[model samples]
Target chain A: MSQLTPVATTWVNGQVADNLPVTDRGLAYGDGLFETLRASHGSLPLLSLHLERLQRGCSALRIPFQGERIEAELNMAASVVGDGVVKLVLTRGSGQRGYAMPVDAVPTRILAISPLPVYPADRRDGIRLYSCATRLSDQPLLAGIKHLNRLDQVLARSEWQDPAFAEGLVCDQQGQVIECTMSNLFARVDGQWVTPDLGRCGVQGVMREYLLARLVERGEPAAVSRLGLGALHEADQVLCCNSLIGVWPVVRLGDRVWQVGDETRLLQSLAEQVYQ
Target chain B: MSQLTPVATTWVNGQVADNLPVTDRGLAYGDGLFETLRASHGSLPLLSLHLERLQRGCSALRIPFQGERIEAELNMAASVVGDGVVKLVLTRGSGQRGYAMPVDAVPTRILAISPLPVYPADRRDGIRLYSCATRLSDQPLLAGIKHLNRLDQVLARSEWQDPAFAEGLVCDQQGQVIECTMSNLFARVDGQWVTPDLGRCGVQGVMREYLLARLVERGEPAAVSRLGLGALHEADQVLCCNSLIGVWPVVRLGDRVWQVGDETRLLQSLAEQVYQ
Candidate 1:
């Protein structure tokens, strides 16, 4: 449903520069961080959360943090459309062909406004999953932070084109379930809502973190735990959550099918209150 | 040493273009392949080898191949610099913000030439190595080919900045020594040269492959074998090779030191024949 719309913006520090330079490290080495935010009725729900995560990611990557400029840019992006998705990309500016960071490099920022993708009405009606062959690397240093090195996700996502499969579950080299390609996986087991710990592999999704806090506030126990294939197979209820896609229940994983449980629906409703 | 001499000419779709759209998948997800070649007297010594490797990388990533245009672009790039280094970057062009490849994508091709980096004369005299804690993932699908998703190498390289430590050796999850950040490792053990197998991790450097073939032709037994830390420490001689560096002897890895031996010097002489 994405039609060509007149999306306009401005870039700083260059002439005729509404675009990033070809020599940007983001393009060269994928040296960048991005935040995809949804704005409804000219206001972003949990905007602070998105900005905090972005700032944290920038700090972790040693990218210069420009909070004031980013807030102004976000406002400008939202002004064009009353409601939509705004993507803010911050790159380590231009550099010569090498991995060493320039001593006096200025960071580049890009802001793009686009219509939020429309999801299927039954997207929450228990989706299907494929166990992706692509395994996430167990890199504690790069894990948890949302960096631009996403080849693993791209490869895993390319494995299937069938609309029937909503997402894919990826594990680490040790066969420990990490998370989905683009979302954080959560499962209800032994009367607790649990998600995989991203200390070893996977991104610490903003929505996943928010859900964990919400569950705690409501006196519902939730935890971040190490998970394995056996845990996934024995999970009473399964769901995937991302900032864009609030919560999606999984009805089947491979040949095993699951029913949409009460906890899954409860989490979906809670996220809808914030996302919708 | 990189002065603004405008060292190279780049052509896109048979026209001179320098800037790519920010939406390019290479910038978005690093969905691209690159080749760094050594050019001398307006000709690339292993041009066919580099092109074949690039084609193989494209085939592995499912990226479209445009060899004719790439050849023409390389010729133009070489014409600008009689002796230099030529870098050819092929990206999956612009796409919507997603991992899925655009159904009809015309890949972006970038060709640039620059002066060869000056290596220290004493670099031939064994260099120090650091065993980095950054472990490479055992992903065979993306292994061997030099793609843009190199955060692992970037992280490993950033671990040290000591001039004495010329290179860092990375290992896979199974504690198998893979390769250096930008080069391939070879060790002379039992009077035979052996390099780590790249079937699971590490990039297959063109120069390393060339040397392997040359060693085989000379009746000097060579092998692609799985290497361990113990084997590396007990090796008779250690060397690292790449297209740019040619061959560099390893004098020390942590506390263990290796003396420059005849086998390493012979390999260096063989590589220098082509490099110089």
Candidate 2:
């Protein structure tokens, strides 16, 4: 028999509850945005980065953002979570059965905490990536923001179930590599770090943003390039990152093989200094 | 100063409840499907067509299809609504915080009934269509099925607020006319019927399917063509159709104007016989 797992504790609109009204537009039409944060020692290290993305998403979608109230709730949840993951879902709330915005709409905020995921011990050193057949749709309007309409990512993630493949590598319709199912990708091509351009498709991760900023601060800025599979295969090193899993070096993808290079280690150490 | 409107009656998993567990994948990632049906005289006329599409969607998404149970629930909801609308939402249900499908996901079914929406009397004669700036993303994996990841439609619908424009015309990123915000489009160009090809994007509506079949039965099948705005401008007649709205002839789009043509009348009559 399987052991009982610790259930997630959730709050809806600052009230402790585990259910949402079925009419909430988040479920009705995926009219919402979400942020997944890592809580460390009762504090969120990159709270500002997450909020910036959330604020941008809300503004783009025309949803009212109550930042002060949301931050207060997030702080409370982070204190309870200590060293786990905190997810925030903001929806346009319930509306009449229509696509038009409700004039008097109140936004719904859901904050929850779940136990930290356990990964293979060696996964930190390197992981294999599965090439997903599900290509990312090129909609610049919805690109680079973490929104609730993520069925594309869901479908890509579903393509592989083997534990050996840590994540799936996704591409756009034009066969250009975009990002992984749940992380952003970076490649070291010809001694220069290059990450895929997310202007057309892909969710921009906070960790990727932080790393890019850090790289810039150190005077070794990474280029945002349009990378195809050929460029990825020819790269000296490959790495993937997100808020949850700071950085994981990709050692193998199909016939291509890579060693955890010095650049990868340096980025991992930088992430460790902050995440730890 | 405002009169109270009749609230929708909802049933979740066969129970009279209006809330769902917050962990549902549908709310988390929009991993679900939905159908909006028009009920008349205590019955759903287009039930079979809706289910056929739902079945195809569930199969494509790897979700379990509980056909009989859903049919029963739809019947119950239709009886209560009598002459209104019935909406069904089927989600992959609650899951752990990840994109990977839970091995044993119990699908969640939500059935609700609301009063019929009322439009202007002149809307039936013709309505203007706003050319939306929001372009549909091209993803064949999620195309042609009414999956719940509909943020594109939500954004397109939000573009215009003019009462004169009843719906918005959405095109794909390639500048091909796809569909309206909430309905499928058909145009008569050079004495031949043409509809936008949905192999790349746009939802394949049940009403669209019904009309296509009806046209085929009359030996005048609509061509599934890749129609650009140029072709649309040259069309003799343009029509939009959905389950609730039945059929509406487009009267105007910007500088271009159209009258209710004879072909549009034929399709309207076909929809009327069943919807009435």
Candidate 3:
């Protein structure tokens, strides 16, 4: 229980609380969405992007989104945390036993702040990835949303326990590299930087979106296409990105190794600015 | 929230509580399994079958099972609620933020009882099913277990609001009829009783397992095979079964219709005895 006390402060539905009702649909049926943002200097740098995705998830799942209230809460939590991580979990709220949607649903909002995880300082330079056996199921309707139905990710993350591997790489049923267990993947294959298309599966990570937008602004948008595991192995450089970790260039995977490329360094430089 | 007050009693890990810690892995990543058993005369008639499935689910998900503690808590709750539905949710307990399995997870067991729902008495005679647009994803790793990651069923159940439809028929990605939103399907096609194989998707209901075991004992084992919508439409009779609902004779689906056949009535009689 002591190890679980990593959360610095918590708020539930605008009130400070560390417990949710047993009947919350999020815990019952995973009927919810979530956003994990990096807090820096009493502010969430990518709050707008995370909120945009949260709103889209709420719309798709038909859970009422409280945009203004959520924004206010995030800002308040960010101020308290100062420099850490803020996680927002919005659920369809408490419902009677069954799958049917409750008409007068009062959505549950959980906001928690935790000290930023201290990773190896050299992780930014390079990190190794474990190839996970768990395959991401293709559900187009739920694709790209940071929904609470994340057992797939949980299962994948459980495949490895070695500290050497910072994360695990996962693929779909057809062996198409989807994304890492915790981060979105980008690989420079044949001189073109590409990220997996998440229309079929995988969460459209906030940092991945930020990077793509940054690339577009510089008129060198990365290609969003399917990359097979074999092609990924032959790639010049591979990298994984997420809000918390910023970006980690892949230096070793199985039997292959690669030095960080110039483009990866550029991406890392941009990430450093946002995470500063 | 009055409708949500249907629960008669609630117990958390043998103690009466309606709230759980916000950091529970069950709410965080849906890292848990659940069982919904029917309570009759201060006892669960199919407790053994339910526990068997629970043990199997926990083993598959790697969540430690406290068999005796759970059984004791279930019995205690059943005695209190007598004739009703008892839901048991077992989670990997609280953990530090992330998907990694906690080394010393104290599994959370939530046992809740609700009064028997007052459905139309004539519903046992016949019921209609909605054809849901939501397709179950093919995740072999998670197939046939009633895990907390049930957004697919939640989405399917939300497709219709018609009270006339007792349940919804869902299929896999390849259009193979899997099961109903909340029950297991059994149909007699070409004079052969068959239920969809849940190797790729859907929950394997306790009632379905019990019925199959009974059939095997009687030397008339039902074949578990892949069923498509087209073949299902031409079936002689269609039925759905669950612990609480017993067995429901599906009388209508889309333009197709069926009658409460002799075999269905026989199964219903068996169910009546268990639920009596």
Candidate 3 local lDDT, B185-251, one digit each (tens): 9999888789999998999999999999888888888999999888899999989999988889999
Instruction: Output the better candidate (1/3) by TM-score.
Output: 3
Tens digit of per-residue lDDT, candidate 1, span A1-276: 022134454343322244566678888788877787777776677678778888887876677888887886776666565578877778778888876666677888777777888878898787899889988866676788777777888888888888888888899878898899889999888888889888877888888988999998999868888888898889899999987888999989988888999989999998889855
Cα lDDT, all candidates: 0.81, 0.90, 0.90
lDDT of 3 by residue, A1-276 (tens): 122222448878877789999999999999999998899998999999999999999998999989998998898888888899899999999999999989999999998998899999999999999999999987888999999988899899999899999999999988899999999999998888899999889999999999999999999889999999899999999999999999899999999998998999999999889967
Model 3, position A195, has a per-residue lDDT of 97
CA-based DockQ, model 3? 0.81
Off by over 4 Å in 3: A1-8, B1-8
Per-prediction fnat values? 0.54, 0.84, 0.80
- Candidate 2: segments with Cα more than 4 A from true spot: A1-8, B1-8
Runs of candidate 1 exceeding 4 Å displacement: A1-18, B1-8
Using DockQ, rank the candidates from best to worst: 3, 2, 1
Q: Once model 2 is optimally superposed onto the true structure by TM-score, how far is the C-alpha of residue B14 displaced, in angstroms?
A: 0.5
Models, CA RMSD each = 3.8, 4.3, 3.6
> What's the distance in Å from true for residue A38, model 1?
1.3
